[model samples]
Target: MSRIAILGEYDPTFEPHIATDRAIAHSSAQLGCEVEAEWISTPDCDRSKLATYAGIWVAPGSPYRAMEKLLDVIRYARENQIPCLGTCGGFQHMILEYARNVLGFQEAQSQENDPYASHLFISKLDCSLAGREMQLTFTKGSQIATIYGSLTAVERYYCNFGVNPDYVPQLKSQSLQITGSDSEGEVRVIELPGHPFFIGTLFVPQARSTVELPHPIVTAFLKTVL
Candidate 1:
């Protein structure tokens, strides 16, 4: 049985976290595979411990107990090419991790974590997306487009921050490609070009998943583990 480490401080009150669990279960059954998912608190995560799992799902609900530790896990997965998914707050940290570690922007910081940082790669959205659903247009020929089987998808969001527009050009010039965007062309999903399954979305696809209709991205992420 393959095991997946869900990295986050599990909170019963968080609906997206709950949805993440259900989505994984639904995807597992659909794939005809038994996947054992364990929630690993961010503070207790380390590379050695994380290596035991076949994949990593950095769940929603951020401002984690140990931000550095969480980033360490993300960095480990990215560097080692481990299958990984990050949504909502996890998506924010994914941008931070890539900017600081891969793009050499050591000062890159999430405004939610450090509002006064010199370089705020992740900033508050002009309009909060909490409890809202929106349409996302996938980049043609991108991984997200292939998974969704269409150029457009309707996704859910519970986030208030996203990649700073000022840094979008710089980020796009790097290896990370903005694979999905909104009608206004704002980034909503990103994928690492050569990685096996490294993708992050500002929208929480898990929330829209069900036994009858499992989200394609969640299924795609699990498929990489198999």
Candidate 2:
């Protein structure tokens, strides 16, 4: 079976682990692949070592250390054309990594980290997204538009911060289209069109998925690799 690397941290879930695990595993099963969770501290990991996974999945967490490792992984994936999916903090870190490394914003940062990195792509939201609903708009000619077939809808969210409202314009101008958003049009999902698969969303798509009916995005992520 093909393998999908889940970049996870030493973390807990305000929700149940089984539910989250099932969401991911259910996606892998539908695509006939194996979902393997990779801890950031794994010994002997490197550029070449990372190439083994067909795709990568970033779970929700602090993403401090996991974010560093994911930066290297996503960079390699971006260059080599592998698939990746980042959800919640996973999504935040992906944007930060791309901004700091790929976009040459050396000090690009998240509110969770420095809180004043000058390029606040992430900031603590005025309200907790916990148990809240959101909507996102897919850009014309973008892959998400092709996937979801339209630009507007509601999604469940569980986050404190998102792509800072200010940087949304600059981010989209840089080919990182802010394809999705909340009802207020805040940035929600970001995507890179050129990559076979590289999409991150402020909402945790996995949480909304199930064995009987998995979410479209998560299923697409698995298909990207398989």
Candidate 3:
């Protein structure tokens, strides 16, 4: 059986984290593939050990114990084209990592982690989407659109922060494509072109997944790794 490493600070009490585990199981069963998913605390994340897993899932429950190390793991996956999925807080860090490493925004930071940082790439949303389900429109021809086989999707979120609108132009103009957006045109999902499977979403697709109805994104990710 293949193994996937879930890099995040585990908190059983957190709903999104719990949903993440279920989402993976649901996807595995739906795909008829036997796989193991191990929760790896962010502080224990190391590039040397990352090779042990077939893929990585940067899960929710942020304000992680070691943000820098978590970012390093994301960078490793992105650079190596490893199948990876990030949701909620995980999505926020993916943008931060991309801004700093790929877009030359070395000072870019998430407001959740650095409220007073000079360059805030990720900032709080005007209307928090915590515990809310919203419609998402995917960019045509993008990986997410292809996976879902449609231009629209309904997803759930448990986050208050997202990609700062101020930096959207730079991010989109560069390599990171804003593949999905909400009705108000806010970025809700992103995909890195040229990567085998690199996607992040402000909405936690895991929350909408079930054993009977596995979310397309999660199912697609597992299939990619398989």
Candidate 4:
């Protein structure tokens, strides 16, 4: 049984379990996988690294720093073949990482970057919807296809940044499938099966979770490690 490590913050957004952390602790317990929860802003991470865990789960956070730290860890973990799952801001950083490292775009960056990146991997969103309905369509015969299939999917969003629409066509052309998106067709879920474990979602899939019925993405994420 591989242990699950949750990279989060002391704040509610990252460790928001009704201010109790129950939502998170419970979700991991249901998997029967030992969990090591760490606070991004504080020193709650064991060994100051995530190399010990079988998988990494990056939670939500405000003020990019919280997410910045989380992204750094995700990048490191992915390079090591440790399965990684990033939600919301975590997802944004994952895209940025792929663009910069995998896609060979060193200048790639997000809206949160100091000089700001002008690419589609990360950019300001065009709408003002919160937790609203977002439509997603999976690529045929892709790993995401096996996960959600060709049926259009729906997921909740609380993000204001997304993979630039202009870069969508290019990213898809590079084999980085647009696994899911909003009704307006904004990128939502992205996956690179070529890697051992790499998947990201613009929304917090864990938000609509429960012990009886865990989110397929979350379950699938854990499966990658097992």
Provide the overall lDDT of each model, using Cα atoms, as 2-decimal numbers.
0.91, 0.73, 0.91, 0.64
For model 4, the stretches where C-alpha displacement exceeds 4 angstroms are 13-34, 42-48, 66-71, 115-120, 173-175
Candidate 3 regions with alpha-carbon error over 4 angstroms: none
Model 3: per-residue lDDT, tens digit, 1-226?
8899999988899999899889989999999999899999988999999777989999988888999999999999999989989989888899989988998889899888889998899998998889888998999999999999999988888998988889898898787889899999999999998999999999999898988899899999999899
Ranking by TM-score: 1, 3, 2, 4
On lDDT, the candidate that comes out on top is 1
Looking at candidate 2, what is the lDDT of residue 141? 72
Q: What is the C-alpha RMSD of each candidate to the true structure, in Å?
A: 0.8, 2.5, 0.8, 3.5
How do the predictions measure up, each by TM-score?
Answer: 0.98, 0.87, 0.98, 0.79
lDDT tens string, model 2, 1-226? 6666666553555462344567768877777667675544422335677766888776676535645656777677777888988888778888887887767887778888787677787888988897787666767777777777677656777778777777766676677777776667777878887889999888877777878877778788878878
> Would you give me the overall lDDT of model 3?
0.91
Q: Where does candidate 3 have its weakest 10-residue lDDT segment?
A: 169-178
Model 4: how far residue 1 lies from native, Å = 5.7
Candidate 4: clashing pairs of residues: 120-164
Could you tell me how far off, in angstroms, the CA of residue 116 lies in candidate 1 after the best superposition? 0.4
Q: What is the lDDT of residue 144 in candidate 1?
A: 93
Compared to the true structure, candidate 4 yields what TM-score?
0.79
